[model samples]
Target: MKKKLGLTSKIFIGILLGAILGLILKGMPDSTFKNTILLNGILKVMGSGFITAIKMLVVPLVFVSLVCGSSSMGDVKKLGRIGIKTLCFYLITTAVAITLALGIGKLINPGIGLDMSSLITQKPTIGESKSLVDIVLGMIPANPIQSLASGEMLQIIVFSLLLGIAISMVGKKAEPIKNLFESANEICMKMVSIIMLLAPYGVFALITNTFATTGFDAIFSLLKYMFAVSLTLVLQAFVVYASMVKLSTGLKLKPFFKKFASVAAVTFSTASSNAALPLTIESMEEIGVDNSVASFTLPLGATINMDGTAIMQGVACIFISQLYGIDLGINALLTIILTATLASVGTAGVPGVGMITLSMVLTSVGLPLEGIGLIMGVDRLLDMARTTVNVMGDCACTLVVSNSEGEFNKDMYYGKDCNNLNKLSESELNKDMHQDEDCNNLNELVD
Candidate 1:
């Protein structure tokens, strides 16, 4: 029998091949085969199909997993603590990310050598951002079905937690529904596993298409800026996040990185934290994070967390300021941190959303909005880098919160006797079932 390749190895190979093929196609003369059939046709279809498949798992998985996490909490106060801790961790890390980026950008001075005379500047018409009142009101979905239909994650999360809390409060009466949701949650996670099997090919297509279509001229022209952004993202992911996970959970960094390798590749290729959420949650479970922490924190982190985006904004702010020869005062620097950090919450987890939020940060710091044009050309590659950090931030927060709650499974996380953890989960299920006879039997639950 042929040896089976691990998911991490397969993904790495895919990324390598994709980059090679993309460079070849990009250098070749324009031809129908390369343009229509290869780049625009097959690669496009495969890449989009992969994204759609991942998204297909998001709503059901998030709703069911979050419901399970909330109901399993057994106490509303515990759930609140989870929420508070998760948010605080995400925000603080985002601030840290931007602060780090600014320091690096200043030291590197990415905008110093670039000639700006020929750069085309535009006045972007940024859409009005949501106010505190609007955000709070939007959290309480007036119509949850509409929210689900629209794939509104915040509202879905809110409604699911409320329903889960009510089920917990009902005591024995909610056992049937709780059991049903647990079964559904298991089934959804299985579906996520199924979707992940397509990741290698999906990542290949996405990366190939990106490099093929995006020219390297912008990248070469702004090499300094690109280097600064890439370096900051790498440091944040490996150095900052790795240290946090180690300090908080006492888990070895090597094993954690090995487990999360595939997740990082997916995030880099797809450039969307929301797209990576399902895989992040599954990987968190594989590495010993409790379902309650993984499900709740990952989804919520994807929705509001923008550590990577904050890094981009931070570096971009400083770069543009240097480009325009503007001396930023202490107050101006503080404004950038505050604006970028808060703007991350309102920003969605999609491509170019960071650039949009960066505009707001620029306005906050009295920088010229046109300065955004200086970095726009190199944003795609940076977007890929930052998205990976965003997902990593989510995983790091999940591990920390789980450790604090005493729900973390060290043995499973460390790759020692994996079946033992499965056995423990099975035992927990049995205990829950015994407590409520009306609950569905374990055998009746579908794999």
Candidate 2:
């Protein structure tokens, strides 16, 4: 018998192949085939279509899962504890991420003698940013249906939390709606599995389009800024997250990352945390996070947690300050830290969100708004890396909170159980899972 390749391996292979194809495409002359047929035609359609598929389920999944998870908790007070703990972990990590970003940005000084000609932005428009009070008020949806239609994640989360708590209070009288949501959750989970079957293909197309259009040209022009952001991301993901998980839960490093690699690949390709939310939750559950905890924490974390975004804003603030010859002293740095940390809670999880928030950070200390226009070229490249870190932050927070609440499965996380999906990296894990009558429909649904 031969071993079958896992999703993680397949995704990596797609990335490598995509990079090769992209580089080849980049070297070719501009033509109708390259622009219209190849890059814009096949690659764009496949990549965008796949992302759309993933996003198709995010709203319903978050809503139903949170409701089901919150209602399962008989004691409503525990909800307050988990919510507060989750926010604290997210904000603290965001603060720490920005602080590290500042340290590295100053050390590298990416803006010294930076190329002014490389900036692609034609205008100095700074996007409108809501005040802190406005952001807090906005979280409580004016109309939840409108919020859901608009995909306002914070608003949806608030409504779902209140509705779930109401159901939990009503006890047996809420059984019908509770059962309805639980069933809907199962369907949403099924949709995630079906969509993931196409991941390698989608990831390949997305990476292929990005590298083909970008090539190596963008990096050299802004190499220092790119390097600073990349280094900070690596540190946050590997060092910050690894140490936090180890100290908090005593979990081993290798298996944890191995399980998370599949999720990382998708997030890196899409560059949108919301697009990756479904897989993020599924991965946490497989890693032995309790269903209730995974359901609640992962969604909330995705919406409120912006550690990776904070890292970029911190670096960008210093980068812009140095580029334009402005001095951001200690008071300004402290202000940046506080503003970025709180802004993390206010912002939604989506692509280009960091850029919007970057404007706010730069404005806070009187740095030039035109500076936002400076890094637009390479931000897309850096964005992929940051999104990977953002999602890792979410999962790490979920694991730690789960442990604190005594909901983490020690045996499963350690891979000692026969049915442990976390331990089973091969195809047999899927086979084993399908043996259960509850999941018997999974295969048929996909078929």
Candidate 3:
């Protein structure tokens, strides 16, 4: 009999095998394999189905988890503190990321002297822009049931938070409501497990489709832009995040990076901070951060913390400006930073969000939104790097917040088994062993 591997181990194997298969398919002749039914029908359909299932779970998972997390605090004041801390951290980091990206993009001049006419263009569709009054009013859902049905995530989140808080206030009377939600949350997690089972197949297809069409040529053409964006992600991960961790928790940078590398790899491949949330939270807990802090910070960070997106906005703004031969004044620079930060909040956690947000940023500075076409082909490749930075920023913030709250465990942060040590202590191990003996004795008695 073979021993069963854990979820993480299985995922790792899936990723490795998928990469090998993708590479093999990549080398085959277009006539031989491009028209193959296996690639077009089986692999593509299975992969897309898996990704869709995961995405379907996002709004519900976030709303329930966040509401439960917030309301469980039992004190409304603590909710305010968490919100303030999270928002401040997000805004500050975002400002810094854009600044760094702007500096690098200007220095590299990736879009300078490039012809804008050569870029591809698609027909533009007008998007509905809400007024401040409407946006605020919309947050208060007229019908929570309708919001969920319509997949209105923000409205669902607002309703869930209000409901959770109301339940907390009702005290003992709210027990039924709390229990119901708790049960619902557990069911949702089970759903997540089912969705994750198909992840390897999904990831393999997504990557294979991406690379098969574009190959390395797309990356090569946008080499300078990609390099500049990539450099920001690397610096943010190693320099910014490492320094923050060292200062906050007094942990050595080397070990922190070692533990973080694997999680970062997943984030890079997925190109989604939210998709990487579970792994990021688990990794942080393993590194000695308290559950309370990890539970609070990581999810919120995944939703709103976007250092990588900020960096992209900065670079994109500069790239657009250079393409149009416009020198960005100090005022324009400040406006870009402010708009980018705000846009990050409004953008949904979906593919092409960066480009949409970048388009918004460009529009703020009087640059043509059509300039987005210049980078669309290479956007998928760049997304991986940006997402890794985004996930790293979230973890870094969790550490900082945890350290400040005095909730971080320094010994565990540097120790191995950071993930399971809390649940499987020496005392628990002994208890389990005794329980096994008792069960055996009872079985013998029955015999």
Candidate 4:
């Protein structure tokens, strides 16, 4: 008998089928479809459950993996160089993103020549902004258990890194705990794979539910805004990242993009930079980045990098201003960039944080926060694309930094063997070790 379709393929089919069904049902009268309780309930349950499972793994995965990666480094100071480079790249790229968004939004004026009476308002619960001292102190985690319980991923990451580094410093004395963490890391990866098995069902539900409720009208209404946002995102991905690749590593742009395209698509579809972290690291390694650098920088970038978010804020600020007929001055534009960049750091890794941060940006520029509702209807659809861009930015930074530090494989980067290079680096590491062991055994026999 022919083999059944795999999980991913199955999910893809489901998604396509769901889209068609949803569109069909959307055109039907309410009384005709309102009684289909079973279908609706199943979709809701499966879709929400899948998202929950994905979210459930995010915190532990980030904490355990960061600890495992950081602790294995064997030196804390080396992280400083990586940290500096990573932060500098993230911040600079974010500024550029916002600038691009702002410039483009102004030119396109997507919100202009449109009425606003129909837009719905969505008020987000705003968190208190802590002082720099408090933020830094919070990083130390007064109680790690509490941090984990609260799902404070950044705090958990910080605590894990510190604990991991301390373990490394303790040397052989900390072997048991170190080994335990290593085992935990492996288990988490297994969990990730298991969860991924449900991806197709989850994605189908997500996309179907979205399209079923949201007809193509919203897209039509926001076409200009979406177009502007997408154009800037693509330009930044190609122009900014490609330029950095050439400047830092002397690598050819075509091959670099070809290697990164698939991973970029995954990120764009998922929208969670953290979710895309594994793929990003794998791709970097396949392209010849050292494990040490890729492992450390990529995770950190997933947490703090906001080039895409920055761009959204920039465009949104301008878009909102045009809607309200307010002209943003030089100072106001500068303020939007500053606030958006900072807000990106503190924003939690959850759905709708982008809108929250965008609200913050609007407030900084004296734009009406209520104007946020104008775009909220279409925000979810745009988020996936922006997120994909965000993940791409993170990976690009990692590649550039790795290249600069001489940690990238120049041959793999320049070669046409991109297909074979797609294997996860961890597997390659295991193969090398097995070969080394065989060689050592032969040498011992000779002696």
Which pairs in model 1 have colliding backbones?
none
Local distance difference test, per candidate? Answer: 0.73, 0.74, 0.67, 0.69
**Candidate 3 TM-score, true structure as reference:** 0.57
Q: After superposition, how far is residue 332 of candidate 3 from its true place, in Å?
A: 0.6
Considering every candidate listed, which one attains the maximal lDDT? Answer: 2
Which regions of candidate 4 are displaced past 4 Å? 1-78, 115-221, 416-447
> Each candidate's TM vs. the true structure?
0.58, 0.57, 0.57, 0.57
Write out the backbone clash pairs for model 4: none
Ranking by lDDT: 2, 1, 4, 3
For model 1, give the 10-residue run with minimal summed lDDT. Answer: 118-127
Q: After superposition, how far is residue 261 of candidate 1 from its true place, in Å?
A: 0.6
Error of 1 at 445 (Å): 34
> What lDDT tens digits, residue by residue, belong to model 4 across residues 1-447?
999985545655766766676676567676534425523577667666765565566556656765765566554355878767887898788888888899999888887765442322333222234544654565577888998887554466567667877987888899999899889877877776687677666656655554565555424536788888888988888898878877877777777678778887887676678777788888888888899988887776776677888888888877766655666776666666666664455233455456545644664445665454346445666788888888778778888888888787877777756565656576798899999999999999999
lDDT of 1: 0.73
RMSD of 2: 14.2
lDDT per residue for candidate 3 within 206-267, as digits (tens), equals: 54554454444323435788888888877777887777767766767776778789898887
Tens-digit lDDT track of model 2 for 190-290 = 77667766767776786676567666543453688888989999999999999999999888878789889999999999888889899988888887889
lDDT, residue 7, model 3:
47
